[model samples]
Target chain A: MREVVVPLAQRSYTIAIGEGLLDRRDLLAPIVAGRQVAIVSNVTVAPLYAARLRAALEPDADCVIEVALPDGEAHKHWGTLNAIFDALLEHRFDRSAILVALGGGVVGDMTGFAAAVYQRGIDFIQVPTTLLAQVDSSVGGKTGINHPLGKNMIGAFHQPRLVLADVGCLATLPERELSAGLAEVIKHGAIADAAYLDAVERALPALLARDPGALADTVARSCEIKAGVVGSDERESGLRAILNFGHTFGHAIEAGLGYGEWLHGEAVGAGMVMAADLSRRLGLLDAAAAGRLRDAIAAAGLPVRGPAWPADRYVELMSVDKKAERGTPRFVLLEGLGRACVRRAPDDAVRETLAACAPG
Target chain B: MREVVVPLAQRSYTIAIGEGLLDRRDLLAPIVAGRQVAIVSNVTVAPLYAARLRAALEPDADCVIEVALPDGEAHKHWGTLNAIFDALLEHRFDRSAILVALGGGVVGDMTGFAAAVYQRGIDFIQVPTTLLAQVDSSVGGKTGINHPLGKNMIGAFHQPRLVLADVGCLATLPERELSAGLAEVIKHGAIADAAYLDAVERALPALLARDPGALADTVARSCEIKAGVVGSDERESGLRAILNFGHTFGHAIEAGLGYGEWLHGEAVGAGMVMAADLSRRLGLLDAAAAGRLRDAIAAAGLPVRGPAWPADRYVELMSVDKKAERGTPRFVLLEGLGRACVRRAPDDAVRETLAACAPG
Candidate 1:
């Protein structure tokens, strides 16, 4: 397993990436701190892995409880977050209580946020079962619920105490979900590591074939890159904006297409392509690289394009994205693979990018 | 003006307490570091001091936007917070945009929360126009909105860079509100300083008469006591819970009677009395000291007894308070004047206190 610490003092936690590492007492013991445990999972992941994760947390812990939320991005709202709070309060969870999120990005985000608002804040562990969470959301401390007006419009930059990405759990993940997770892996490459991008491109076949070693390496490398960026810019002050490379265009797609209709990472995959295409159009990137990027995403069997929702709708949706300033949308544009900067391109360029993204 | 610092590195700010701190550039200068300002106030405070505060800020700043939210605790909700966000976003507010919250606790809590959540976070100043805010809420980093399920159920610990509490502003406050602010003033005395409590009792007449020096001293002492408590226990791990001396019982009153029925400080005033009485009953407090504490609040003309609310209702409301654990209520019981501790007293003790609060 590889470990990457996010460098936040006191609130910092290490991300553990390896196959079948969830049951490792060495990693779990230090973070849990002899507190009562509450495992928050979802219906989909509960039956598969919750019991095992709970059993593994034990022999040493007591007063443990489990509350499973309904699975899916659709449930990442105030209601779902309240259920976790209800469970915490009902179970008498206190400042010392530890919440273990045992699912994908949705569970991780919601559980972290619940910990944040529950008595100002509490400690939570991220046991990301999905690849998307393993590399991206699980590493960053951003936790919040989606506002009807925007995605991730409300949240806290709450770092986790520890993260355990048990790749063994991924065996039960749906094919569509696995494809979605790749979008984030691709994001790390696009923003900070050209070599990693090349590796992902070259090893797409083995990674797709669910080769455990390749999958684990990709997750760890993605985490290492993210941890470095987050360490320097914990709250997306500057360098972290690069991590949102395709997110500006991607979030617009998720919102314009109507949320839940598109998996976040899937929208992110298509969004990365849109950003690359825009960079190519702006002469900031090579057309060949853009094609390679798009082809690799397509080769992974992820959607590359969708019917154009109105450009205006995309604009409206992007306004509420976390990267948005006041109301003006901030785009994380590429200088090239492995380099990104935030700036406002010409309106025509943004409109054109939206126009190009329309279904063919 | 007396100044108190929260002492948190990078996120720390000062609380300036005096009769005319707002008119002084020294306090405002350190906080308004930029050329643009956003003064978030309410109609009640805007007509009174917005122009003056804006003038003080404008000499060194430009493009000031004054967004007026409806005045009152009833408006401290998600919709109102969103207005602040919308205005900030609508104006292309950068991270440097200074948000000045220029009203009482409601405005401070909402705007501070908005600053905390807006674009991950931003700079804000607390130009608190009410005494409750000046003495308590304005200095603490606690920022959030009341959820449908609980008060402060959604929030972050985003501290303001500066707090300018012009005691002169309190001159225009209505009598009921003035009395309400005294609850926090009394709270400072109850939890930390015995001499301060004696001084408050001695100076009650002058304070009621709005003597500038007397009022300013009260405000300064309160902030100093709060800063000391907060600096030691920023996230309420221990010492900070003492600051909630009246709040545990107060939240129950506010939630039980419905949010708008009693202003927060008013409920806190009554709640303090009940807690003191409970502590007396528990033999953890001296009966004479408890009586004196209750008398101090009552002499301030604030409620010393809770209104008739069902036991089940109080229980339901208290469970959602920030101090609650699992469905169990946690009350901050006074050991004596100037000292408080968090303890789970018996249900019978709480019932007796409530019975004492029943209208004859």
Candidate 2:
């Protein structure tokens, strides 16, 4: 098992990555003991691991309630979030009750958000099943649902009590989902660690083949990099915006294509490509580094280009993005393979990137 | 002008109480200067004050948008909250935009909650137009919408950047609403200060008549008490629960009668009476002290007795309250006129209080 602690003072918790952690009752006992525990998972992931999690928690948790949310990013809305609220309310879960997120990013974001607002906040544990979640979303306290107009428009910064990332769960992840997870893993490397990017490129085949050691190593490294960024700026005031390097354009893609059409990581994958191209165009990153990032993403089986759309449509969507300040979209451009900066680009320059990367 | 500072470290803010502070753009300029401002008011209060607030903010704010929500507690649900979000997204409000809650508690709560979650938290100033909000909801960071199962079931503790409590607005407040506000005023005294309670009782007629000095005095005092409690325990972990002095039963009344039927303060008015009775029954509070508290509630022209509901109905409702722990409702009962404590009373003892206070 590998452990990474998010240093958020009182809000901090440890992320544990290993095999068969789904059945690790000893790990979950301290938080849920004598308390009613609600395991919120998506329908797809629920069947795969809910029973094992329930069996693990059933011994000490006074009551283990299972709430299977409809799976997919499209269902990440207030109505879907209400399902978790309904289950908890129906069961009379109180402020002291604990919520365990037992699935992928959608489940983790929604569950963390529900914990954020339920009775003015409560404790929650993250049992991220998808690589995207284990490496990125689950570690940071950023949790929310998407609005029709924007992705992740509604949310809160509610940290988890514990994050149990069973890398073994990746064996069952869809090939497409696995690549989506690699987008963020690649992002962690692209923004902070050049050597890790090289290691990831070398390990891509093993990672795609579900090699446990490679998966655990990358997951731990990605968490460490992300934890370092999030630890310094939990609310994305300044330095933390680097974590959204691909997210600005990626969120535009998600909103433009409609949420769930392309997984968040897929949008981010193509988004990172667009950002690198823009970075190269702006004279910050060289062409070779941009090509290297694109190759890594493409080799991971992720999209390297955005869906065909007019520059205006992408700009309109990006303008409403949470990253925008005073209606101007702030792009997280790469300064180099291991450095990122947030700044607004000229309209012609942004339009050029949109035309080249997302030709209609 | 009278000011009380809520000392919450970096989240600390000032509560300004005076005759015509609502029109004081100088106070708001510090927070809203150069930022796009959204003045969230209800229909009733919007027509009355939104324009004035917009005018006050228009001079300094880049753009002042008005979101007139439906009035009353019934509108304190997600749908109404969505209206604020819709307007924000429609106007392309960014994370840097400021939300100025310009109505009563409902507007303050929804706006504060929207600020808490809109783009994962933003700055909001509370220009509470009602006494209930000025003294209670606006001071603390507790902001949320109600779930169908319970009052304030879904919420977050997102504090405001500044609270502008203009007592002059009380002159336009209806008689019943004024009484409702007094209930919380009495509670502030009942929970923490006997001298303040005495002052409130002595000046009941002046308060009822909307005396500016009296209203400002009481509102300032109540804010001081609440700020003191919240300063110590911001999350209601321990000492803060005492602030919910009558909220356990109050939430039950509000939930039982259905929200909007009894204003939160009205229900709390009756709730305080029931809590006094429960305290007397438990021998924690003497009968004379309980009677004096009941008389004060009645003197404020607020309901001293609950609506005729079966004890079991109240019990079932209270059991689901946010204050409950593991399905057992915790009551904040008085130890005397100026002190309160949280504990669970025997079922029979609780039933006796309900029979004595809420006969059905």
| Candidate number achieving the greatest DockQ relative to the actual structure | 2
Q: Write the per-residue lDDT of candidate 1 for residues B19-137, one digit (tens) a residue.
A: 77667765677657554689999988898888888878877775789999998777777788878877876666666677888888888888888887665567788888877888888
The digit string of per-residue lDDT tens for model 2 on B250-284 reads: 98998887677888888999999999999999999
- Candidate 2 per-residue lDDT, tens place, A39-136, comes to 99988999999999999999999899999999888899999999989998898887789999999988999999999999888899999999999998
* Chain A TM-score relative to the true structure, per candidate: 0.95, 0.97
lDDT, residue A181, model 1 = 91
User: Model 2's CAPRI class?
Assistant: high
DockQ, cand. 2: 0.80
Cα error, candidate 1, residue A110 (Å): 2.7
DockQ of each: 0.34, 0.80
Residue pairs clashing, model 2? none
Per-model TM values vs. the true structure: 0.84, 0.96
Candidate 2 off by > 4 Å = A308-317, A351-360, B308-317
lDDT of 2: 0.91
